[model samples]
Target: MRTTRSYLALALAFVLVLTGQSMALARTAPGPDGQIVLCTGTGPVAVLVDDQGQPIGPSHICPDCALSLFQALAETAPEIAAPTSWLRAHPIEFTLVFHSPAPRPAVARGPPQAA
Candidate 1:
């Protein structure tokens, strides 16, 4: 019981951390045509921007990034504004996987002695 509760607490903490990290950045990101404002690795990137639609930091295009919401929605489907042909070139794909806890091994005990 304790282990399960601890695991849940740990999971909650992790979720909060991730949520906070994502919220730290502005909700807005450059549109599909929008360029990269600033990025660290080839994966996740945060394109900085001022009130105006202008790059406040170093902005560039991420070639490694398979796809972004703007691109996917713009090209694949008509969710946001008009569709874009550019997203066609740079396709984006997102995958989700589910994980399950491993079963605990059965404990062994010696035969009970006669009372």
Candidate 2:
């Protein structure tokens, strides 16, 4: 009986650790539009804006990947707004945004080479 109990406990612990790891990988993001967006693992994503079209803090459960993206955006887009109070009260919506690299302008060919 003692051996059986010990085995069961060990199995349970292993299962718990696996579950936690899975959850960490799948981080969740919140949108201000009352929607929850989950990081499906594509690239850096942004949170949706609320009714006022403003960014909001993540919901209670901040996923690891989502947090990383958020921190990056916060550094660049400091002007981005968030609904702190609303997020505190309601569940946050996590969404993904696809961002493309900006194109560089071509250099002028010396004032159009007077033909």
RMSD of each: 28.6, 23.7
TM match of model 1 to true structure = 0.25
TM-score of 2: 0.25
What is the alpha-carbon lDDT of model 1 when measured against the actual structure? Answer: 0.63
Task: Please list the residue runs of candidate 2 whose C-alpha ends up more than 4 Å from where it truly belongs after superposition.
Answer: 28-115
Error in Å for residue 45 of model 2 = 23
Off by over 4 Å in 1: 27-115
| lDDT top scorer | 2
lDDT string, candidate 1, 35-84, tens digits: 45455577667665555666666543443453564676664554577655
TM-score of each prediction: 0.25, 0.25
Q: Model 2 clash tally?
A: 13
Cα deviation of 57, candidate 1, in Å:
16
